[model samples]
Target: MNQYQRTHETMAAYERLHLAAAEERGGETLAAAWASVVRQWRVVLAAAGVGLVVALVFLAVTPPQYSARALVLIDPKNDFSVRATRAPTDSNTDSANIESQVEILRSDRIVRKVIEAENLVDHPAFRPGVLSQVLSTLKFWDRETPAKTELARMEATTRALQKQVTAKRLGLTYVVELTATMPDPVEAARVVNAYAHAYMDGQLQFREELASRTSKALQERTEELKKQAQNAERAVEELKFSGSLQGENSASARVALKNLESTAQTYRVIHDKFLERYAETLQQQYFTVPDAQIVSAGFPPLNKSYPKTLIVLATALFLSAALGSLLALLLDRRFGGARLKRDHFA
Candidate 1:
């Protein structure tokens, strides 16, 4: 036989040896196991009682957490956006667009903005959460950086905040929900509200930046157009003053004057159009609005959302029963009230 086969057979022999010992003490049948458990019911109850006491102690020590949620509606087809962008949306594009907005809500940019605006780095809820504390207690991390440099502390705080915050879309709808869970219900609600406001603020800031860039570009273009118009007008004026009618070159001079006049008129018209657009851009800045709006504000939760009493108690009871049953079965096999005959094995 191969080495693997031999190893498997050896393990199989060991299991059979243990099973034979079990059968030697009592029969290896479901009814036999159930009878053994029934016989040792007192021990099982005592073990379960002890487990209940321990569970009570654990529940007393566990901290409570509360979650608060806020809702935001994303309208991608806002008035400030380009006409082409506001066109009828395709299903694939709309779905992708909503998904992208969800990611933006989770993005570091939006998170950091909220963090800074709400001063979350200095907030009481800014520590690594319960799971991280448990892992740290188990020595899963070598060096903790939250207590290190200022930048490191900020980064650590950001990570902690990110963990506490959850951003997701509700079904396929355009409404996005942002949730924050904290030991303090008020703080949790505040954080969720801050996130919603920050997202809308970010959109407003983006539009302002876009408008600023456009204004600067238009100003530059308007100046260039004005310069061209001036040059064309200057050329036409020079041609008129050059005595075109008295010269043998009057025919050619008139033609050149006509062309220059045409050029000046064209430049003036283009420059006027740009001036009008620049004025419109400035006006639109005043009427600018965010594409996203807070549909529902977060409120402090009335009850703690974590370390539920019934769940903890039920879980402890279930585990205790299972463990007690296993122990009782083993004890019965060790020293049974009734033993089975092993004449067949012999």
Candidate 2:
């Protein structure tokens, strides 16, 4: 036989061998795949057992967290003071205002007040625990700096408290939800309640400060106007008396008196307006209107919020099964293919 015929025979033999191999493997039947999985059931169970143990260990070690929530209503319409002064023109303005209030609820000023009120600075949740401090000292081989300043410690506590608290606006509504999470349910509730009160107090303080300043300015301006009005009235009287004493009531003298009287009247009008404003500002200084009202107060949670055992175990089981199945299939393909190649070559 020539070289070309020999090459053709070789190609035909390879095709036959491929066909025989496919037939021997039953052309990838479902039964065979299931059998392959069944044969590797031990591997699957072992992986699942390992995953379950790890999950249990995590559940044992991880601390449980509790969440407390406070609801606040930011109703501009209900605020008689603000409504009397200015009304929002559109819904967009109202939405923006609500969002601004949400940010304010999460502000450092509010968070810091919550921390200080709850005395959370020394809390292990917010600061390092005794064990952790000892470990850190050992790791640093006693070369660590003395300690953070009081201001730095307070700032750190504030940041930690801020991380555990969240403020969210409830969908197009005038309500905001303040949430705080902590290991202790009572502490969580206290922190959230403190946040609401702090925000309310802060708003009142801001308004009182503004009103006090305005009252002072108005009082000073009214005094100055009163003096000017008095001076103008005296000038008019002096001019009238001088004209009468001289018996010289001329057109020019009359014009001068009329002008002075008009100036005095203008000052009186201005002084009266300032007095009214001053009274209003004084009232506002004592005003007790709240910018936000607590719709729902936070209470100690009945159940822990973290380390959901069932969910963790379920997720571990699912992932372990998937991983085991993939490994089993890969091993079967590798060893089975190698055996087939050896058989075919022999």
* Candidate with best TM-score: 2
- Cα-based TM-score, every candidate: 0.72, 0.79
Q: Which ten residues in a row have the lowest lDDT in candidate 2?
A: 76-85
1-346 in candidate 2: lDDT tens per residue?
9999999999999999989988877856656666677777887788888888888899899999999999999965544333335755688888888998898988999988877777888688888667856765686543434364466678778888888999999888999999999999998999899999999988788777777787798899999999999999999889877854354557777787889999999999999988987887788777757677899999999988887778999998899887887777777778778999999999
Using lDDT, give the best candidate's number.
1
For candidate 1, the per-residue lDDT at 192 reads 90
- Count clashing residue pairs per candidate: 0, 0
Candidate 2 TM-score, C-alpha based: 0.79
CA lDDT of 24 in candidate 1? Answer: 74
**Per-residue error at 230 for model 1, in Å?**
4.4
Collision pairs in model 1: none
